[model samples]
Target: MSNRVLMKGNEIIGEAAIRAGCKLFFGYPITPSTEIIEYLAKNLPKAGGTVLQAEDEIGAINMCYGAACTGTRVMTASSSPGISLKQEGISYCAAAELPVVLVNVNRTGPGLGGLGPTQSDYFQSTKGGGHGDYRLIVLAPSKAQELYDFTLEAFDLAEKYRNPVLILTDGFLGQMMEPVELKEKPTSPEVDKSWVVDGARGREKRIIASYSLTNEIGEANNLRWEAKFNGIKEKEQRWEEFYADDAEYLLVSYGTTGRISKSVVLNARKKGIKLGLIRPITLWPFPEKAFIPYKNKIKGIVTVELNTGQMIEDVKLAMDCCVPIYLYRRQGGMLPTETEILEFLEKQFKLSTEEV
Candidate 1:
């Protein structure tokens, strides 16, 4: 027996947040991600939780910052444009070392692109969305099941690291519906609350600020944050490999695009193409080690992305561009179908064959 149900990706995120012990949610509605706010508004109160529809994305994130600093589990969600507006607040949360969860249901965009699914936010998310020497724990879930499971884990990771955690999904996964098992809500890891601002009733006054006027103090704070990031990089890299055991070519992708590329790998294998897929679950840590083993073994690597080639830069850094590395991309919310991806791979194969 299981508590399985069919749910849209965005709605599942809402439900998972509640089950993850999130007590407060503040967000401004945006395409593809609006369902999360709507679902939470309707359901969270039933479970003694609170949801607020803020005036704007900026307002919503500042609200999140306030709630999180009080030691309450809090989250906020938005799309690319809205996420841009929230960066300043996100930086504040990071500098203050507040544990918060931010969900971005990415849509195509440089500015006001359609509501179509896109992964163009990779740079914004993984490279520290705000201005600072900080990093976020980014989780990319391709399916509804991973959306639910990762949301459950995100809260704990945020608390454990005392940093903001981001659940990065795109319009495709945000709108699609699938059957998923709703597991029992896991308890968040217990952390010291002595630093929280709760009126300072019985202890010394506590302050949470992202400002360090003096150069010496600023350097010290940044050094400590860098140490934490190094620890996370070592321990939190996560990824999935399919058909890579004897693969001669590797395709790197993440989120919904990763699943599509997996299908391409399967079809290519049937035609004796020897293609493999490496789907990253954690984007910030970037799963650099995942490429190390295949570096010498593979003849070439191709990175297929929803954006022009955001993650490919990280791929190049990971593999040092050892073998021939190619980029196959479609932007502005266009998805790359299996046939198109296969054709691209075939073109590369033909070129290699000619060279040989």
Candidate 2:
């Protein structure tokens, strides 16, 4: 508690990684996320950790894959375009069942868009941007503190599930400075490393590969991966609710958008509007269970985002289309103001803005 300090979200992630026993960082510097590598480069060595700036995102992620096989915690950070470059390596890590932490501080992007903040990478982060039936445990952090806490949690989740875990943030959250409490060191517990390919000096050699030469082996691998994914889905769904117990209209968002929507919910309530919010912290598992309590209560749901519409699909599926869902988005790094969001809700729900 005495360790509280004002810090950028990206730097907080680097600090959290250091405390979590992550000794290796391999990444190329990219805006919105470069601070992560920079912070780690300066501080990680002090913690007896090593930081390497790879020639490219491809090299960086492959480095992560290699380190993960050694049964050690390693991480990489990049923004949208860099993250896209690392997808194949990410898929390889997933297929190899490696435990690695990845950070995507998203910026505007179709391809090299700009340094402006945006949630455009939501699809890529949550929908298996790489190839061939794989899932990354994606966690969305809405604030600077969450960026710190979730980084610690991501390392643990990646190792526990033996898969890649992604901390999906954006340029805004990554660069934003806020006061955050630095939680105590070493939040991770020891895990079994008998599966690692570390050493075979006195025992049988261990091989870690993703290749499947036969259809039978390929299908079996896919089936096993699917079972593991199902287990994650069943156990890891997490969310945060705001004034949602008996609301009629719901706002669903994550990351930066979730932060803004929190205020919109409060303002709407003050004006006597029945508004609530559900912020999904885990994007992969989708937190469908969070909608269960609101299913019979809410009239409609609106998904607010920095992109056109990606998370709305998950929201619709979560409710099974039993409730009317709408979208309010700002593209090309634009952020929707709380007033704009409230206006949209007022019009959509035909609710009064009169103060109670």
TM-scores, all models, native as reference: 0.97, 0.98
Q: Residue by residue across 1-356, what tens digits does model 2's lDDT show? A: 48899998899999999988899999998898999999999999999999999999999999999999999899999999999999999999999999999999998979889877788998899899999899999999999889999998888899999999999998889888999999886646778888998789799999999998999999999999999999999999999999888788999999999999999999988888888999999999899999977777779999999888999999999898998899999989888999999999888877766634
How much lDDT does candidate 2 score? Answer: 0.92
lDDT by residue (tens digit), candidate 1, 1-356? 69999999999999999998899999999998999999999999998999999999999999999999898999999999999999999999999999999999998899988888889999999999899878999999999999999999999999999999999999999999999999887566677777888897877888899887999999999999999999999999999999998999999889998999999999887777889999999999999989989989998888889888889999999999898888899888888899898889778767342333
**Candidate with best TM-score:** 2
Please give the lDDT score for candidate 1: 0.92
Count clashes in each candidate, considering only residues at least 3 apart in sequence or on different chains. Answer: 0, 0
Q: lDDT of each model, Cα atoms only? A: 0.92, 0.92
Cα lDDT, model 2, residue 121: 90
Q: What's the CA RMSD of model 2 in angstroms? A: 1.2
TM-score of 1: 0.97
Model 1 RMSD in Å is 1.8
Candidate 1 weakest lDDT stretch, 10 residues: 347-356
